[model samples]
Target: MSNSSLLKTAVLAGSLLFGTAGATVGEEADARKILGSMTEYVSSLDALSFDFEEYHEIVTTDGERLGLAASGSVALVRPDKIRVLRRTGYTDTDLAFDGQTLSLTDSDAGLFARHALPGTLDHLIDTLRDDFAKPLPAADLLTGGGHGGLTAPTAEIKDLGVGVVSGMLCDHLALRGEEADWQIWVAQGDTPYPCMFIITSRNIPLAPQYRIEVHKWQAGPVEADFAPEKPAAATEVALADYLKGARNLPPNFIVEVEK
Candidate 1:
């Protein structure tokens, strides 16, 4: 084989496999063991609810990119419910999930937008594939795989070692995706939390880079009221009246079918 061919083969071999037969050998063996243990720690979770503060910034070229620094309080009620309230300097946007529908209300703009919610966890994971430009393959949590109600990631993964993230120790998830290579840091040591996840672009335009940072998390029911707190200035109309006005809009005005 040529030098280039040989080099490519070596890298592929490494991504697919990790440890080799040995009586009492290297660091690779231990990392594999921890990845499995951590996977189980994460997969066995039944339902989880957490509150977080996310700072999102997106800068696009043709008015497609959203760039702003914001701080907010968010609440997620397992299976499918999420509420996000953010203050972007002078404006506030509330993103709420009500089982099957998501409401995006711009408090300052005086506009309300809604979208269809993804039904399943696996589907939500798939939805992110296009947005991040990096594929999340099928697998189980313990084996570098995706975990949900009925699906999982089927990627080959090797735990390198225990790495510190956000002041906690976590198992490093290093593997290959369907469209490109990937890396995610899973909680390992004391915290039992997902430290961070990053997906780099594969074959897409607009220099896409997606990173998710999970801060303080509380995995259980909490005292949170998700009732829509509409601004007092918003035109008051009965639900029946609002529904009447909605009928005048285009069919399926909430979530649009991509052309």
Candidate 2:
């Protein structure tokens, strides 16, 4: 997407989310159809690459809101290969999964960690979220599941009609889950792809949010994208040991110990 389009999309998204009209039943049904088609379309891909900008909102103890931003890219291959790189003001990190092992690199710190794991993309997400408390960048949209498992019984969904995202026209859909409320904008037409996603934490004060804007997409990703390049001078460390001292390993990064 071009810079002009991205600006337009961002402006339109803000207006729609905070100022749009209420949704009708027909709009809701259309949203479901569009999202279902999008899931199918992404599932058929053998590999994919896209650039993303992530934003995080935090509420301070005194009720002041602060925002943080990061930009990154994701590369994925079906079954069991993926890579995500994110750069923030303080650090740059990369996570890679190669079917057999999951590796994380803290480039600025010259530290790397690896864990023995074998699974599909879905399994990797589950492991990261459940055990490591690390959510993959835009995992909900790109995963091979209907609406990325957003159609839960407890979720209240609605379609917010046409909106722009990354300068592309999109169908906006909102979902209120038990813990979070999320909105997604997917491009329309034969190649319906997601352009943006925003999630608000309902359980937190002031409803802090995490927003992601997708800037570009590629149909196929080369092997090098998911393959890790270990720095010769980087120290090899255990996942636990590495995470112990790691700061901001990712927004929700946590190391869990099992009894």
Candidate 3:
């Protein structure tokens, strides 16, 4: 696939999560409890790992199905480190995150690109569970109006009924933002971690979905790798020259492009 397609995948995968409506008096009480517990569960997460197998299919507005594609063993360690390494029908690609940088290296295309992480490790955990597409609602749920970042739905007021998600029972809720709408389901009990999330755009013809599962967790003071030997100099002559002449990079940050 082209790099733009991959970038769309990445940008789409990590959207914001939030409640657009303010809750009512009695209902707000219950919603607050559920939302609070859910927050605690996520806030308490640290040093965990997840391994997931993903299936991706992109059908453009024109009704072209790129066809069903799948991958195995998508792994991650908290604090912005991820590795999508597996054999599959799709492109052979390597995506990694050290604590500070995100890199995508397409071996088949001999291309690589990197960008800086805007915040601390906790932010990454919030991003991971959002979805394969990272729907914006997921991001808002975490940022919550601090430091001029995105805000999440208070979902505390919606009279969302119960539903079965991926064989697990959960409370279903609906929320809308200025730019999007969300349908999310979470575990019914205390600390309701998101079982599934879906997002739809109001102004654009884009509807993307993300399903997240906590496949596994590993404990430690370990970090993910960011540097895997710079791209081959000969292969990246133009890119290297471009970087050498680049400007305006944030302090303590790195920029990488692979092609």
Candidate 4:
């Protein structure tokens, strides 16, 4: 797929959990307020860390839809420092940005890439999408820089009331966009943070979904070590080359058998 298509697919696919219940005006307003609170509270934090479990549905060439799972952890410090580590069945990767430079490493391939991109976390997200044609899932919530970044494209909103995620009670919300539908569960009270997020493609044939569940959320001062440690004997290559090499890795999803 083309870069633009990739971005759209990622955005749409990144858009999942919701209910079919109709919402009243008051409930809609309440839902919007809850989402806004989450944005504000997450953005205001100086540092935070969270573990996430991700599920992505992929359509195979034969038109079979299969699910892929990955787990990762994210650590961020306000202004311009962040580290993301993801592990899948096929590969283990690390992406780090330390204000001045961006580093990506594929431990399985023994290859790494570095680029100079000096700016805030928001700028980093834009560069990744526009320049590098990369997708950072849940980026809006993670960076929390752009106002209404998540809700701006929303066409409708619904309050699904409360739901439990990992045994924690959360306020559930469902949102509809032009090309996607998404849901979020925000933990109630003073520290309003997202406990779970899901995005489902509305335009895609199979309506594939991408889901993220946050676990072990920690907010406060954390070590700002965004620079990734380059593995010994690993080859350093251009960013584009690293991305190309990554595309050749083994498929991350498994095909389901007919029951």
For model 1, what is the alpha-carbon lDDT of residue 214? 57
Error of 1 at 82 (Å): 2.2
State which candidate, 1 or 4, has the greater lDDT. Answer: 4
Best by lDDT: 4
Q: Which runs in model 2 stand beyond 4 Å of their true positions?
A: 1-21, 144-149, 221-225, 249-259
Q: Write the per-residue lDDT of candidate 1 for residues 60-177, one digit (tens) a residue.
A: 4443543334455555555555566666555666656556654555555555655465574445445535453323222132122454211134234456556776787777755545
Better of 2 and 3 by TM-score: 2
Q: Which stretches of candidate 4 lie over 4 Å from their true place?
A: 1-19, 145-149, 247-249, 252-259
- lDDT (Cα, tens digit) per residue for candidate 4, span 95-189: 99999999999988889999999999888998888787787766866855252236676778998889999998999988988888888899988
Rate residue 153 of model 3 by lDDT: 48
* lDDT digits (tens) for residues 108-211 of candidate 2: 77889989888888888887788988777788767733333455543457887789986899988887778888788888887777888888898998999988
Go through the candidates in order and give each one's C-alpha lDDT.
Answer: 0.50, 0.79, 0.48, 0.83
lDDT for position 225 in model 1:
47
Model 2: lDDT to the true structure? 0.79
Which pairs in model 4 have colliding backbones?
A: 15-199, 15-200, 16-198, 16-199
Model with the higher lDDT, candidate 1 or 3:
1
How far is 81's C-alpha from truth in model 4 (Å)?
Answer: 0.2
Instruction: Give the Å shift of residue 216 in candidate 1.
Output: 1.0
